[model samples]
Target: MNIVVVGGGLAGAHAVQELREQGYPGDITLLGEERHLPYERPPLSKGLLLGTEEVQSIFVHDQEWYADQQVDLRVGTSVTALDLDRGRVHVGDHPIAYDRLLLATGAEPRRLPILDALEVPVLCLRTLDDATALKSHLAGRVLIVGAGWIGLEVAAAARRAGADVTVLDTAALPLLAVLGVELAALFADLHREHGVDLRLETSVVEADGSTVTLSDGTRLNPDVVVAGIGATPRDTLAARAGLATGNGVLVDARLRTLDPHVYAAGDVANHDHPTLGRLRVEHWDNAIEQGKHAARAMLGDDQPYDRLPYFFTDQYDLGMEYVGHVGPDGYDEVVVRGDRERRILTAFWVRNDRVVAGMHLNDWDAMDSIRQVVGSPRSQAQETTARP
Candidate 1:
């Protein structure tokens, strides 16, 4: 069988590797829009931005490895169209036929609409090129829009690089969606303690050249501006190809799309999560694991992808980890393992006396225990006592 995997991010790279390792002797073609080989993205904001990690070290596999695996790598080529009925993908002037296809397009960074209006140079941290540019332009004051994980990470990197850093967010507390109010407040304080100028409940009305005007009419001159709001999945290609699309390319428990021959995985897939029901994860671990599972399913394995989703972020000395799913609403109680002031906190969202979701900050032990509890069906009391 011939397999074609599009978008050479972590998911695409992992899928191709898994397929070859599983003894798939068929022709495998990995198409990537980026000129660089597949590389890890998690380091873009943390290590690379801070100059602790080299760009060449990010690739999970080297060029020699791909050749050894007998996988054809097509770099710097964009898949413009998908001919579902014809079983072919169009890349510029070339069209490649495939017996099966994997969509691992990943996600693109979200940009502010008025990004051009900001007279000062602005940067994003989605790609290696973006990180390189931002790193080189860190000699002056930097202002970041949004206090999410990426924004905070960039802020940390800039501060370490001796640049005056400021972060602004419209929400009353940054990280509200992930950590909730109580924990988010603690994170806000963490930034302030590190000498970061953080403005909460503040909206950017206009940005021009060297100044950003806030809704409160406060103007600040900055040399660089960064918008790390978040990302949206690249689902248009799959949707246009007539596959089910909702939030992301919809898939079943087996990671198979409506069309059995086509599969979607990684950040671009909205699969039926085992414990959480249906959800889409943008986590780095989820992308690698899910991509491997999808490749297994393509090899005719009856196994269903049901791994517990996990994600972690590094900000200064803090290591934040999150596991499981907690809806925006519906939580009866919150269990805190350590006080926020101590700089070690783990909060569990308890519903119906069961730990539904959790977040950890510097609480490594709690993070390990929570990961196990989230995977198993157990009451909060039992899980709490089981933890040492």
Candidate 2:
């Protein structure tokens, strides 16, 4: 059987690795739109942008590894059309037949229309080229629109590079979507402490030349403006091919699409998580796990992908690892323990007397203990005893 995988990101690379490790005797074709091999994106916003990480270290697999494994790695090529009836994917004029197809197409950064009229380079951090271009202009006055993960990380990196950084957000604090108000406030304090000019509940209204007009009529002349609002799943290709899609390509717990011959993983797949119900995660760990899960599922493994959601982030002196699944407004109670002033703390979101999610800040050792009580009691009484 010949297997074809779309995208060349971490998910696609991991999926192929899983297939080969499972001893599948199929001919694997990994098609990438870029010339570079599959690379981890987390480093793009963090280490890569900061000039601390080398470009060669970011790749998922070396080019020599692909050639040695006898995997057909097609770079700088894209699948224009896919015909499910004929089990064929068209790369421009060329058609490739596949017995099994995996859509690991990742998401793209949401772009703003205001950048088009601006003379100064408006940046977005998503790809390798984006990080490279952003780093070059880091010495200037950087105005960041959207105080989300990527935006905040960029601010930290730019500040480290001696750039005057100003962050604007529509929300009250950074990471408000995923973190609680208290934790979000902590992050806001973190940035403020680090000399970031953070303007909360603010947005860009107009951009003319080097000056960007804010909603509050505050005009600022910044050399570089970055739009790091968020990312939107690259599900258009799958949706155009008539696959079921919502926030992402809808898939079952086993990572199987509606069509038995097809599957999706990574950021593009809206998985029906066992605990979280239908959700699409855009983090690195989810991509790696789901990619392998989908690969195994394609090989007739009956195991379901039910691993707990987890992700990590790094900014300035703060490092965090969080686990579990809780919507923005889902939790009923929040309990924070340890020295919040020292930055060694753990915050637990409790719902129905059970811990739905927990975050460990600075104290990485608390992760294991935090996991034990995630699905169990997380009340003030329990939190009093289980303070990590």
Please write out the lDDT profile of model 2 over residues 316-349, one tens digit for every residue. 9889999998964488877888778878888888
Tens-place lDDT per residue, model 1, 229-286, is 9989999999888999988999999999999899999999999876678888888999
All models, RMSD in angstroms: 2.0, 1.6
Cα-based TM-score, every candidate: 0.95, 0.97
- Which regions of candidate 1 deviate over 4 angstroms? 375-388
lDDT of each: 0.85, 0.88
Model 2: weakest 10-residue lDDT segment is 379-388
Give the Å shift of residue 361 in candidate 1. 2.1
TM-score of 1: 0.95
